[model samples]
Target: MPLITLQNVDYSIGGPLLLDNVELSIEPGERIALIGRNGAGKSTLLKLLSGDLRPDDGEVRVEGGVRVSRLEQEVPHGAEGDVFDVVAAGMGELGTWLAEYHHLSHAEHVDTDKLAAVQARIEAANGWSADQRVVETLTRLDLDGEQDFTGLSGGMKRRVLLARALVSAPDVLLLDEPTNHLDIEAIDWLEGFLKAWPGALVFITHDRRFLRALATRIVEIDRGQVTSWPGDWANYERRREERLNAEAQENARFDKLLAQEEVWIRQGIKARRVRDEGRVRRLKAMRVERAQRREQQGNVRMAVALGESSGKKVVEAREVSFDYGGKPMLKALDVTIMRGDRIGLIGPNGSGKTTLIKVLLGELAPTSGEVRLGTNLQVAYFDQYRATLREDWNALENVAEGRDFVEINGKRKHAIGYLQDFLFTPERARAPITRLSGGERNRLLLAKLFAQPSNLLVMDEPTNDLDVETLELLEELLGEYEGTLLLVSHDRDFLDNVVTSTLVMEGDGRVGEYVGGYSDWLRQAGPGQVIAGGGRGAAGVRNAAGVAQDTSSTASGGTGNAAAAAPQATAATAGNASAAPKRKLSYKDARELELLPARIEQLEATLEALAGEMNEPAFYQRDAAAIAAHGSRLGETQQALDAAYARWAELDG
Candidate 1:
């Protein structure tokens, strides 16, 4: 039986129908990617499934005793707990028992029998090492367990909430934009974690790579209905396109018939016959249908016109180094940026990607070395934090602030006219900034930024909170942009689509330049590939294939591949080796590595059996405490298995 089902579900907020008579069923082990345009009720549907919201009409049913967990887009207000407390809350009844056990163990004059009973209960509930598991999860997400929730940044808080939802190991997990604040490594880790999940998983994300890698089914919320497609994001896109094309053709035929009917009605009949009356009614219905079709076909077009060209050398950084409080962030980085170069800056959070951008833009002076900007280098930067926007102003005022008109392609265009190009209607442009959806606000910011012409465009995290449609439009605009582009984004697909080269920041003050995109960089930096300088070669010159290119030749305008210098070996190995010896593994390490696969398989089988038992109708009728204990044990085992796999990967690498 399906774990959860939504039957004839209808929901609305203040006015328009968001979901109308939507039906859906989620089966075990199904990974569903919920996708839609902004404001398309994807979040609403997830809320309904998670029981966080009730539908105005129809029923949402869950199988008996099925557990559900959700990760909301916004962190709840007034959460006073620290990271550990918040994540542990997901443990539910098991957490209660664990707390009691701790209290009992510490109390003076405690009953010895009671203490022994509580100890057994702790073992049964898998609460013995719960704290360790929680800490591990926090570390993996780059969060500190002791950090106060109130003091955490918006992105950090979001990660905490995500960790909570994950630690719960629910039968059905509903996530809304789980990747919003995550870096590339965290996202990659989440992909692997979700793929190994044994329960029903449904999530909303704009990351194309995430959807393609994890989604077994795609559920799109469109036109007040939910449509399901089998397979990954690529399959869904192809099918959706075909479906839309067919609908467009059918609408064309309907329009022709309606036109004929209108002409016949204009001919003026003396008495209205039954057949004529029927044709008139059909024509009216066809008109309504056409209007709806037009609404469904709403598409936004984004265009960027290049401004005056800068010099051939747009930016040049020579041996740049930056440090914060004597801690090196960037060390001796040399890079040349030419006009029309599309470069993507990528690194983990707090790895100095932003600092490098500042150094290049001359916003911050490097501790050592120099930066040179070419003549007539008009730079327009889009801040990821949206710091330039005025909250008191409406969308129109925000975009049109400080000017009656803006110049685009050497033509003077009115402010409102420029706003219209970003899909903001006159009415919507008058709406307050607070009333706009995240995507709308982002679009408004883009409208304001792109209005002025610039030879160099710098954007940081531009894809955050943007719907897939808008993301695609932005990608298209960037592709056609005839200017120097410097972007920092975590979206792998977006980087692959828009950037020609990537600048990777490997922590501890090492930065590398690789030609092509993020994927190309990953391929070249894959396991067992030796890193030259801290993590990259000197001068950091790499070809499209990510092999080190001769920096001397490139600087002289010659295209030639440079052989990398080999590492020197110690005397013992260098003198007597017929072949380089492999690194010897300890006995315990070797045994564990050999047994990990079978152990993982055994754990998976055990987990599946536990889930089967918990789902049985009789399970709920049994002792509630016993059921809780089994569930907690299952969660613990899963965590253990995940750790084992992670360790194996690390050792193998």
Candidate 2:
């Protein structure tokens, strides 16, 4: 049976429909991703699912004994309660009844009628074992630790809320933007937890990585309509692009036919003294048959204009050290930025990407050395705090600053006309800045920023509030941009799509540069690379040797290249091969450590494949009998891979 169902649900505020005849259902153990542009009624749909808001029409039904838990973004943490206590609230209803039953049964003076009633209620609720269930649920959520939950950061607080929701063991769980504040580590942890979750899940999130990792099906909401696609986010994206392209072609064909028909009607009607009945009838039919063309194009493309390149050395840091509030964040860091460079700054949160940006921008003075900006470097910085715009100003005034002489289409244009290019309608242009949604605000800011010419662009989390269309636009612009760029973002899609070099920060202000995407950095950071370096011997080297070695290992592609860099082998001055007998590896030990990295890579490939399969609805239904068959293999593969990695770590230790 479906865990929850909604039929012909409609919601309206002041006669404007927010939700129009929307219907959806959730089944047991299903993981669904809900996606839509901002203000497309995603939050409203969640509210309806959780029973917080009743539909204006139609029915919402739940299977017998089904319960639901929803985490609302606006829901305050409620007075003075610690994190664990809040998660414990999910069991509040059950706990209350249990406590009441206990008190009544053990009361000093129990009335006969009350005693009978309490006993009956306790039997109905199975109240005797509620505490055990609550304790188990809390532990699963990782919230039962003795650490102070109230003092946890924003991401930690979100985890607590998730735990609280899970504590009830609800039949269906509704999550809204669950990963909005999470770092990469926390997201990976959440992904693991969700893989093992047995309940139905309906989550709304903009994190592409998280969606790809967890979602089994994609549900798109638009203009009061909801459609389900059979695949994960990536597949859904492909299908959407294909459909849009087809629609555009069909529309073009119709437009050409309509133009031909209009020309015939014009010539025919003018030649005849009066309109012919058949021609008029044909023209009317054509007019009636033609579909109304959608006036608004629902895409915001960022086109960044890169100014003329400056001489080399766009930005330079010399023995830079920085301390914030007397705590050292960076120590004697030296780096250089050159013209036309696309550099990505990455590190764990709180490692001071923002501080470094400030130092480069001359907003913060380094404690020791200095940061120098190249001569005539025009910088356009996208600050993370988007709310800095004046809330009272209209959108056009905010973007165009009342510029009436701006050249557009080879003629001077007004602020309203310029704003229209950014997708703000005439009515929307007059709307107050505060009335715009988060994505809208970000778009306005991007429009304003891109309109100005700059030699260097420094963007921090540029993808945060952008929709898919806007993000792709920015990606294209950044790719074509000839100016220098410094970016700080956790969005892997954005990083991989736009960046050429990575600047990673380690603890104690140490910085390292890796020349590829985040995945490349992860592979390099793995145990094999670390152990293989620093002149280790046969124990450290894997089977892949000679020409089979990865290019990333050495600057040159020669066997002598690897040996020349080895500090140990340079000691030929001391002895030949006969002087030191090579150690022999036992077959058992060799087998144990030999295939560890290969096994790990194989498991990663399998996991990615399984994730891709789960994203496909057609695959899930068409191969229902094979679900467990594939799932079990995946599980076994993962376990073996994990064991191999752990064993290798122990041996290497």
| Segments in model 1 whose C-alpha atoms lie over 4 Å from true places | 91-144, 150-156, 269-275, 287-294, 402-405, 526-653
Q: For every candidate structure, what is the RMSD over all alpha carbons to the true structure, in angstroms?
A: 14.5, 10.6
For model 1 the local lDDT of residue 257 reads: 86
lDDT of 2 by residue, 388-453 (tens): 467778777776776654443245556666666667778888898878876677777777776666
- For each candidate in turn, the TM-score is 0.76, 0.70
Candidate 2's C-alpha runs over 4 A off are 10-23, 73-81, 89-152, 249-297, 305-308, 405-413, 526-653
Q: Relative to the unseen true structure, what is the Cα RMSD of model 1?
A: 14.5
Candidate 2 lDDT (Cα, whole model)? Answer: 0.66
Per-residue alpha-carbon lDDT of candidate 1 for residues 616-639, written as tens digits (9 for 90 to 100): 435534443464466466656656
Q: Score each candidate by Cα lDDT.
A: 0.74, 0.66
The clash number for model 2 is 3
